[model samples]
Target: MAETYPVLQEAEPFYFEGNDIGILVIHGFTGSTQSMRDLGEAYAKEGYTVCGPRLKGHGTHYYEMEQTTYADWIASVEEGYQWLKERCQTIFVTGLSMGGTLTLYMAENHPDIQAIIPINAAIDIPDMAALQNERETRFLDAIGSDIKKPYVRELAYDKTPVKSVKEIVMLMEKVRNGLHKIQCPALIFVSTEDHVVPPGNSQMIFDNISSRQKRLVQLDNSYHVATLDNDKELIIEETLRFIKRS
Candidate 1:
């Protein structure tokens, strides 16, 4: 028999049905749905239906991540979106890091997405061209768990697969190029002290997107994983306000 492993409590997916306005939350590249749990729950409490899907190869072993690509992750998001679409009259998408990138991609391709919230969305990373050229190694140091809050760790693979990193780089380029297609209102958050993603990523999105109704908020106290850091409450409040006004 093949070996099986139980999913960690924090890594499990979460769904809460509440109201007609549904929210689809997406986590980072190697990170699990736990990263988005608090935000999803907050939105759910506000009488909005919410779903956070475990991305392909995440919430599992690192080797499994090597077998997946960005397309697989996007497919997972699409599945969650379809699930929410069936039950809700309107839908919004939110994400952190690569999750943010996926959020923008969905907004571009899916015209019906009511609004988008992308925090610390990855666009261009440092030396991404060289990283894509790497072939000798299959993995690199993990960049997913970059939270600055002490004792609070983001659940992710110890090592990031180079293949997956390349996939993310490709996804960033694709999303960046297609920013013009994203017409929905967007509320972007950029953490100034982010250790993993450069602040320029958020700036790139803000500058390139054709959305006339867009705003950028800078987070001074948090790191890349701002959803779980010091400014988490601020994010929650701002997102709620944005949803109401949108």
Candidate 2:
């Protein structure tokens, strides 16, 4: 027997029409476009076309994610990129957690990407050995909603599929190996108190990437889900500045 979960309305994908500069906003693993909506809207308000794509198998149910692979997630973002490429002259990519990882992956592959902003991206999973040993467990406790803000929770799955975790691990390895291939200007954000991804992961990305114009900004007042946390405004302001300058 398999588990069943309902689709969340708030997790649907979003697109906003604006200027010729397009922004592709991606959400974290186990999370939907809801997590990145505020950031995308901020860009849209500033006259940048924004598209927030709901990754395949996400925003629906964890059981559905079990049926997906990292390739499927990549295809989802690639489609969004193509959509923006057709409408805009310049394109920027940004994402959170696994979304951030995929952002880096895109920059590595797409030399023409104007710039990149990866927030709290995951490079290494600390509990990989333990997770691999859990052969009997098909699911684990949710890793979503690690926000510090009160009365706010991330719209994400309540459970994490073990197989999906493995898929992300594979994606992380591929991205990690290709870090030096990324030459686009980058603005990397790391939450000092992130409970999901180790803060050191950001440092590793900063050190490994070949971007000459890369910066690491530390969020002192947020958790893993900084996009929806107390420092959300800072992330938006700095990102807007980065986009303008880049």
- Looking at candidate 2, the ten consecutive residues that score lowest on lDDT are 126-135
lDDT per residue (tens digit) for residues 79-194 in model 1:
99999998999999999999999999999999999999999999888766469889799878887767878988888888888888899999998998999898899999999988
Clashes of each: 0, 0
lDDT winner: 2
Residue-wise lDDT of candidate 2 within 108-200, one digit each (tens)? 999999999999999897685257556788998999999999999999999999999988988999999999999999999999998999999
Quote model 2's TM-score.
0.97
How many backbone overlaps does candidate 1 show? 0
Q: Pairs clashing in candidate 1?
A: none
lDDT of each: 0.91, 0.94
**What would the TM-score be for candidate 1 when compared with the true structure?**
0.96
